[model samples]
Target: MKVIILAAGYGTRLFKDLKNDRNEQFKHLIGVPKPLLPIGERPLISYWVEALKVRDDISDIFVVTNNHYHHKFKEWAQKYPFVTLINDGTSSNEERLGAVSCLQLAIDKFQINDHVLVIGGDTLFYEDFHLHNVIGQFETIVKDNNYANLVLSYPCKDEETRKYGILETDENHKVTALREKPSPTDTASRQACPCFYVLSKDSLTCVQTFLDEKKNAPIEEKDAPGHLLSWLVGRNPVHVYPVSGRFDVGNLESYITCHKYFQQNIRNIPTYLQ
Candidate 1:
């Protein structure tokens, strides 16, 4: 399997927060990319690199970034010879390719033909998250059907449903539908879907197909990766692996919360780098 980290986003929310803050300590972080921001002792994306480096299943690791931060990512990636950083050729959010488009770009640029594990650069899970467990689940499902794809989900508050991709799963945990930021009254299921996905080789082609179908639609409909998954549920078999929780570092407050949690529980969090 190949791993793709989506890191091309401009991080407008986090950048804005840092720029307007009066705190002098955080002033240096104003222009840093979200994925490169320090979580504890290492960058946010380094946690994933350290974890996946121990897994033999992953053949190649690719990080997709924008032109503005490409040089920074390249310099950081120099220490890790295994990683290859791809520039999406967009300097700002307005010109940036959406998440789905970036995924497609990575696939095309790398010529990946194996099962791909796609992860969000700015997100991490709690101590309960195990990559082996997720890969095991995917292997089991593929035994019955090679085209099956796996995604991660966790329970969230009812009011927070609008902040994530709400998933409606059946008794067997097969995703019936995926609603991107649905209203609170729309569904009773509070399973919030994260950007972590294990896409089968057959399902990778569907990424381009989904983009073609949405060529004429609004940008918002195709921007988030959740929208692509929402469209794939009906055409492919999508399964969910429920986890404890995840930390989405969107703003300064959320970043601090995740940093503190990782710092306080450093021993429990597996890095495999040691």
Candidate 2:
């Protein structure tokens, strides 16, 4: 299995918050990339790197970032020789390629044919998230059917449903449908789908097919990776793995919240610098 980390986003929301802040403490983070922002003693993206290093099945790790922060990512990747950084050739948010396109870029650049584990560079899970267990579930599903894919989901509050991609799963944990940021009354399910995904090699081609089909559509339709998964559920066998919680560092409030949690409970975290 190989890992693909999507860090190409321009983080316009976070930048806006930081730019308008009156506090002097946040001045240093004005231009920092979300993934490279300090979480504890190390950068946020380093946590994911440390976690993947312990997995024996994971052979190669690829990080896709835009040209704006490409140098920063390349400098960080020096510590882990196994990681390869790819530049999407976009310098700003407006020209940036979407998450799904970045994933496809890594696949084509590396010629990866094995199972691909996709993760968001700005997202982190609680201590209960075990990569081995998720990989085990993927293996089990593949044994039953080669095209099966696995994604992580967590329950969100009713009011928070519109902020994420909500999922509805059958009794067997198979995803029945995926609605991207639907209204609260649109569905009864509160399962919010994160960016973590384990895609079988056979399903990689499906990504390109989806993009080709949506080439002429609005950019919003092809931006978020959930949009692709929303379309993928109907055509492929996708399963959901529930977890306790996850922290998506999109804005200043979320970044501070995640930093406090990691700073206070760093020792108890199974995946923290291990």
What clash pairs does model 1 have?
Answer: none
Least lDDT summed over 10 consecutive residues: which range in candidate 2? 265-274
The TM-scores of all predictions, comma-separated, are 0.97, 0.97
lDDT of 1 at 220: 76
| Residue lDDT tens for model 1, 98-217 | 999999999998788999999999999877778988999999998889889999999999899989999999999999999989998999899999999999998899999999999998
For model 2, the local distance difference test gives 0.90
Q: Flag regions of model 2 displaced more than 4 Å.
A: 268-270
Angstrom error of the Cα, residue 271, model 2: value is 3.6
All candidates: CA RMSD (Å): 1.5, 1.3
Q: Looking at model 1, how many pairs of residues clash?
A: 0
Q: Where is the poorest 10-residue window by lDDT in model 1?
A: 265-274
